[model samples]
Target: MHESFRLRVVETKMSKMSKEMIHLLGNYGHIGFTFVAAIFIGMGGGIYLDQKVFDGRTAPWFTFIGLAFGIAAGFKSLFDIIKHQNKEFEDKD
Candidate 1:
């Protein structure tokens, strides 16, 4: 008598996620994580600039320019993300 055990190499298909889905999820996750990270970084930078350039030093009224630029960049990134999401949805449809 020969006895054999069924080996599951790929597990159950129902429990596995597609590579595309995983990749998309990873992209969105990184975007969200980076957005959060950039917020913290921007806040730190803004505070540093406020203290070092605007509060303590007698400089031009351009100290907050960098902060404004950083905020604009963040908003631009958000706009790009929304555009990309819309394009993806259109493509899927």
Candidate 2:
């Protein structure tokens, strides 16, 4: 009877852990997409400027600037998401 009770306790803990893992993954998926989209948009804008305004002479310069902007935007977005999540958890508590 004691061994059976211990086994049940372990099973319960495992199920709870699995649920938490799934929830974490779902949050990560949203953040991942946001980061990718921000980067692409920034880079695309830079490429367009370089091609139309710079006449392709400064092709790579604009592209590099766009990439930097994209990286910064992505990190800012990630931080915002994390801050929001933290606030949510705090409210729940």
Candidate 3:
């Protein structure tokens, strides 16, 4: 009976830890996806403007601007996620 009780307790703890780990992984995946998505969207917009609107006259200039914007947007998203996570942790405490 004593051994069985201890085994059950250990199993419960392992299950809980596994769930938490999965949740953490999901959060990280979301953050990475959002960051990359923002960058790609920004770059795509810039490309559209340069090629379609300017007829390629703007060429690399618009592309560079767009790339810069994309990078900035990515960083902004990363920071925002970090802040949100920090807030959640604080609330839990």
Candidate 4:
């Protein structure tokens, strides 16, 4: 019984530590993921337009513009997410 009780205490401590680490890491990770995803989406959409828009008429131009727009849109979405998070924090405060 004593051994089991001691094990439980150790497990509880480890769980708390892990939870704190996750909280610390999660915020930074989310930001990094957002930036990477934005660039990827920009490049992907650009390539898609290069392939699908037309054949040599203006495909390359479309691809470049589409990619630029996609990146902008991605950043905008990230900004919105940050704003929402801030609002939540403010509400809590």
Every model's TM-score: 0.49, 0.68, 0.76, 0.61
TM value for model 3: 0.76
- For candidate 4, the 10 contiguous residues with the lowest summed lDDT are 20-29
lDDT digits (tens) for residues 1-93 of candidate 4: 999999999999998989657855665457767877887888777776677656456667866886687778778877877787688679879
- Per-residue lDDT over 59-79 for candidate 3, one digit per residue giving the tens place of the 0 to 100 score: 988888888999899999889
Runs of candidate 3 exceeding 4 Å displacement: 1-15
What are the per-residue Cα lDDT tens digits for candidate 2 across 1-93? Answer: 999999999999998989778767877769989999999988998998899988899989998899889989999999998987798789889
Q: Assess each prediction's global lDDT (C-alpha) against the native.
A: 0.62, 0.89, 0.87, 0.75
After TM-score superposition, the amount by which residue 29's alpha carbon in candidate 1 deviates from its true location, in angstroms, is 1.6
- Checking candidate 3 for backbone clashes, the offending pairs are none
Candidate 2: the clashing residue pairs are none
lDDT of residue 31 for candidate 3 = 80
Q: Model 1, range 1-93, lDDT digits (tens) per residue?
A: 122222343434523657568757755756766666656666667666667756846343334554565666677777777788779779989
Clash totals, every prediction: 0, 0, 0, 0
Q: Find the candidate with the highest lDDT and give its number.
A: 2
> How does model 3 fare in lDDT?
0.87
- Candidate 4 clashing pairs? none
